[model samples]
Target: MNSPADSGAHRPTPVAVVTGSDSGIGRATAVRLAADGMDIGITWHTDEDGARRTAEEVRAHGRRAAVRHMDLTELPDAADAVDRLAQELGRIDVLVNNAGTGTATPFLDMEYATVRGVLDVDLIGPFLCGQLAARRMIRQGGGGRIVNVTSVHEHQPRVGAAPYCAAKGGLGLLTQVMALELAEHGITVNAVAPGEIATPMTGQEDEDVTSTSRPGVPLGRPGDAREVASVIAFLASEDASYVTGASWVVDGGMLRMGPQAGSHLESDAWRRP
Candidate 1:
């Protein structure tokens, strides 16, 4: 009849809640953090199997793994998921707000519901989860880490991605504000804006990282999910304690190609929706 805390073979380890972790950058980040000696709380929206696999991978690294269902469009539910994870794991040390959605419909043709869906999932959902995690961290008496997974579009824009660009832009600014307010509480808020990565979201599932090329990107290839995850791991680590309110771009200089230097090819190509 031992207490749960004393029953564990090992002492407590930090825990991280990674949303949309059934695949893509979420899964990669979860695994990487586990390798960094942190237990993982894996969340999935639609892919239960993927989430289970991610949890298994985390456990494979000799860390605790808990799976939770999360859908960002349901903000209240999302917050509940966070609370459950933290409670189950004893505490939440990090939260990666990676669940999001985008749209390609023309703005004029978009319905109110469509736009609202994107905003709810991308912007409002992260805000809710961030608030919940921050509150928990404050209660726990130690610092915590929150990494928002934005996109390169956070600073730029594309034609068909009006809703997405708007949400990411809003989240980017929100990240700064959260950092400013949460600093005194020992919670560091930051963002990771990724470029084109070879993942299911990019229609490049199962693509080999060693054999991919993207000519438009200066690096001449798509980024691997692990590459982005590495950056996230760094931001969540104690090493980044002094860093906050920052957006670390993992794009291979894609944003730098913006409009080019002098070739002003001003066509309506930007509105390709």
Candidate 2:
């Protein structure tokens, strides 16, 4: 009798665990991946209802969906949700570290607790979660994908966002290191850095981005969640098998405004932060 390996068994359907999938880019990415024929593991912090809604969307695509709660600020324990979702969904083939938080206080006025919370949610959370996902992928003996959702601040600085920029910048570099180290295991890591997007995080959820105005941004407005999701979907697909350690900027030319913005500013409002 032939053994299981020699029996030509079919592989299970792919599974993806997207953190903070209750809304915004996370929700859009979960739906997009489901449409790509992968089961989804959805996570939410305070928005269980929104997570259920996201799961409904995934199921609408005829893919399996599992829901969990993940509070990144909770630290090493929060990452265990990845393992639970992977087990429930049969396997973990992709991990999108989309859960994060930020602060708007100036550097001098920022509290230790606030800075720590931002770092925990944005940087350390992804770090621990990536470790868990990568271990599972290595054990499964196949390739995997990890997409870290950073910000345009990952490349530039925002006046009011000190800890936020630091966390994102650190995550951007961490993606590269993970890509380099995990290449041997066939796990590609990448960062999706978005500029100003119309998400609840930015107080623009459900807003019509086309109608918004932003003189500093080359696109003249904010980006839709789906726009960012499309790029993330590409990075999570086989088409990006050869691509890794790259930060795909979906910012609508916001980062390119360094010189122009410096010259066009009319007041000291930029320094008030």
Candidate with maximal lDDT? 2
State residue 222's C-alpha deviation in candidate 2, in Å.
0.3
Over 134-158, each residue of candidate 2 has an lDDT whose tens digit, in order, gives: 9999998778999999998898888
Candidates in order, TM-scores: namely 0.90, 0.92
Q: On residues 1-273, what C-alpha lDDT tens digit does candidate 1 reach at each position?
A: 111233255535788999889999999999999888888898898999999999989999988999988887776776689889999998888999998788878878988888988999899999998988899889877778999999988988877788999999999999999999999988899999998888998888768866865556666677899999999999998788899999999987778868231123334344255
The best candidate by TM-score is 2
lDDT, candidates in the order shown:
0.85, 0.89
Model 1: how large is the Cα RMSD against the reference? 5.8
For model 1, the stretches where C-alpha displacement exceeds 4 angstroms are 1-11, 259-273
Angstrom error of the Cα, residue 194, model 2: value is 0.4
Candidate 2: regions farther than 4 A off: 1-9, 259-273
RMSD after CA superposition, every candidate:
5.8, 5.3
